[model samples]
Target chain A: MSRRPSPSSSTAVPAARYLIGIDGGGTGTRARLVDSAGRRLGQGEAGPSALGQGVDQAWRNIRQAIDAAFLAAGLTPAAEADCALGLGLAGAEVATRRERFLASAPAYCKLALATDAATTLAGAHAGRPGTIVAVGTGTIGLARHADGRETSANGWGFPVGDEGSGAWLGLLAMQIAQQAFDGRSAAGALARAVWRTAGGSRAELLAWCEHAGQQRYAELAPLVFETEADDTQAAALLAAAAQAIEATVVAIDPRAELPLALCGSLGRRLEPYLDAATRARCVKPAGDAIDGALQLVREQIRQPLAPGIP
Target chain B: MSRRPSPSSSTAVPAARYLIGIDGGGTGTRARLVDSAGRRLGQGEAGPSALGQGVDQAWRNIRQAIDAAFLAAGLTPAAEADCALGLGLAGAEVATRRERFLASAPAYCKLALATDAATTLAGAHAGRPGTIVAVGTGTIGLARHADGRETSANGWGFPVGDEGSGAWLGLLAMQIAQQAFDGRSAAGALARAVWRTAGGSRAELLAWCEHAGQQRYAELAPLVFETEADDTQAAALLAAAAQAIEATVVAIDPRAELPLALCGSLGRRLEPYLDAATRARCVKPAGDAIDGALQLVREQIRQPLAPGIP
Candidate 1:
């Protein structure tokens, strides 16, 4: 529901001209509603929205965020059919999970779905055709062709891959921590910081390799970077991380001369660490994914899908 | 307990002129008894010898190994009173646990204790003044001076620092496995081998990390290396491991060209991967750690520990 005048229930059947865009992620789900004028009518947010974990959890959060926005805008629940939803969900790349999400679709005016990376691309180009490289807890390269073709590379989970990602950096930190603990490698303050941060006794640490977790490991990565000011191992790990990032870029469209966007929280945080060549390879996007979603929604209302978006 | 009669014992009351060497490690514990003539009297083996995890189990294994050697030579347990034990144990590196082991000292005629690394050094140069760079499940460089001054580097632990050891290699393999799973890396057969070896389910693997233990990790190292034939990630890991080994050597005694004695199962397996310069830098011992322990026992029997050994 929006603060605007109600047209859905009127006998005249006035057309509703607005769309809702959502960026569904592990941390939280964010929703923005915009009309044909490109003005935001309402915005909302809620908890974890990774679809692969489960659809119930994902939609629950999405609905919560949307409901909050609608309530604040003084709209009634009866206005639900006046809006279309465009969702960019994390972990939607899996075929089975995507199918399950499509099957359980809400009875909105219209709904469309795509992977988080694809949304990131749409965001990068403001719904236009371009490529985006996201470096968060994981790494992924995605591109949109003018002819509607899409391609992707690298976005593996941590341990073996996830180049230039939080997981990659975290794995390297673990290596240095082990060396310092055993007296094989010298870490000085870095070792003490890691021990304090990781929260385990020496005996417990002796058994750390056997019982480590993703969150526990992910927690140590920032500490490694923090210690890079003086610790050799930490410094080396950072350098290695930087190299991995560069390699990922090279792997994707080796000659990225056109507009290329760097997306994700990690990309922003590690921007300074990126080499000159890699930096030169990127171009700032005109608008983000949410803006792209808004633009998508507004266009659909003005000139509805030719064949009704099959 | 020697099948061959000892010349010294022939004098009726046996003068203890021989020594027993015990090398207790994660895989197993081994004992060797040698006479004054540098001749082997008997030898024995048993399992789970690390003190911290299994004191009762370790003692049980030790007693079995020792008893078997004597029985094999048709000797009575009463003869145990005439033997001195020179023990080098794995968990001796842990301060509290080592102290506990020392407090519960087994009933032997006489004994001296140190880390398995220390005993390995004693075996390498027959307790003479020299350096030993040990590469096993972990890597450690130890140097003993004439005045008993000792210096060590590396052997930090796996997932932190182990550098060029089995645990180091195994952890690297896991990183590749994770990468392959995410599609950010391609590990081919090596990835499948690890999945099979580590238990097929990712959730099971996640759980395994909570308490996988050292032996489980050490066992997977060979599989990592075997995958190098076709897996890019495995090859990269091996190359990185080789570089780490070189870095460890440099950290040990950069200036002095000391005799580097490489030992351990991993060291033997990675001989081909090590660079020619690093190979030339090493002085490959003629025997393994157990043989070295046996040699030390034989030498000590021939010429007692020149006063200071006690």
Candidate 2:
């Protein structure tokens, strides 16, 4: 949705009018608009902006979302250049992709970039010391220690690592569908669901996979949750997914000293499947990734964060 | 290696100077030349000729090997058109690829085509009824019943089905490398071998996968066999592969009545891992896929079979 700042907010443009915080991931991009005084102005969103999907596509989606946020804020497109931008994006850890993403920058007053995992941790803990397990289209666990030393787990990519992620779950589901098609396994409820969506015949399934990527596969993940109640195979998949999430929880904070929060839509949905030990460590996130992105630019520009607003 | 027919065989030109049988797969192509009287002449080899790779590449490799065979036999390239050609090609099951391959046929006097799996089954039984599991770069179990009915299992494609094939083994090995890199699993010998070959860094690994296909992954499969003795993970992968092969065996012949032959290099290597019950159904093939391809055209052209020669 587009958001436009009110006339009063636009009038404050030169001093503190616009701050755009972007959370760009494999599935979509979200932009949160705020004034320099930390007042929430508006929010905007666009399609996938993961640099790994290609730098050009990432830039296009980011620009679209930034423009959307400006529109939502009641500001003209030209006002975007006056806004400070903080972007926490997927694939930001890869040096080459990160470099390319930054290199293709559009005009802005100021800008900062970091991995989405980093911002997720910052947002979950509200700039405090805690760990976050992000389980959206992908999965990653990151911890920001009180000492400022950071550690991470997973976040590897689709079809390989990123265990317990939506993509991983859906990938495994596809494997099951394939096995069923080959008569190596039975066509259970989950398989039926996959077949219905992916095409029933082997040739059709192959054609479906020919163009499928991480985002397309992740779209199938909801079936795992939807069918888990009645299908043993689906339940097993969910259990394995939970185990993967638990591994990330332990891998990032083996000592169990840090407060942990599941920070993505799927992560929160997988909550009931977690072990008691992991559940005990879980805490509600104080802020969202957008807040952390905003916090990122605020720190860089030395702007004051509204007291206790987060 | 190229095989050229002897001068005496070349003299029999109009009647039955040459017959070429080709076994073409994802890894490489082989051409076998024989005279009208069914006497073995020479053999030639070339690179991958799988039609799914591209019709042009397949035709290129086939032509290279055919020319090599004619050259080896002390015959000129011009003699190729006078030969009867029979091709057992991987990806022949893909209708589009098969159509393209046939449409691009050279001026061979007579030509016939079938899937490599079908040819393997025919060759394994020397034109009799039997079951064959061909597990080279890809895997497929096919059975030709006495009644002329056929059944198949697996062979869906690489990185999907294909079960215990070389590419499947290598693809699984890649997964281990990825999981180890992500700290989701320990780095075992298999993972170490993969990292050494694929590159040690995450970016390097991702780059390795960027251009990797079935053939590239199959190159890493030998390590699974080489390291299985001292590495539990590698052993586990082999055991799983064996199980997949066994599943294919059962799927194709539930009654275990048909004589079964494992037709690929990996399939033979996995023989020792098969259970005694599954192994009991196994038999050495009477001929290879090249032999079957010739027999196919020999039947089609109503050529007299040399008595008792398979």
Candidate 2 residue-wise lDDT, A110-141, digit = tens: 78899888888888898999999999888888
The TM-score values for the models, in the order shown, are 0.60, 0.88
DockQ of each: 0.20, 0.41
Write down the DockQ of candidate 1: 0.20
**Model 2 interface DockQ:** 0.41
After superposing candidate 1 on the true structure, give the runs of residues whose Cα lies further than 4 Å from its correct spot: A1-160, A166-239, A249-265, A275-310, B1-20, B33-39, B51-57, B67-84, B103-111, B170-243, B255-257, B269-281, B284-288, B291-310
Where's the lowest-lDDT run of ten residues in candidate 1 chain A? A5-14
lDDT tens readout by residue for model 2, B1-310: 5444444443333354688899998778999888889988778899989887899999899989988887888877655567888899988887888888888887787788998888888889999989999888888999888888898888877655677888888878988887777666788888999999999997898778766877888889999998898779899988998898888877777788899999899989999999998898889999999999998987766643233432
The deviation in Å at residue A159 for candidate 2 is 1.7
lDDT, candidate 1, A66-140, per-residue tens = 886676566653365777777888877766677888788777776767777777788788776677778777777
- The TM-score leader among the candidates is 2
Cα lDDT tens digits for candidate 1, B12-108: 3325555667888878888776665557778878886777566677678877777776766566644656776667777777777767766776655
Provide the TM-score of chain A alone for each candidate, in the order shown: 0.84, 0.88
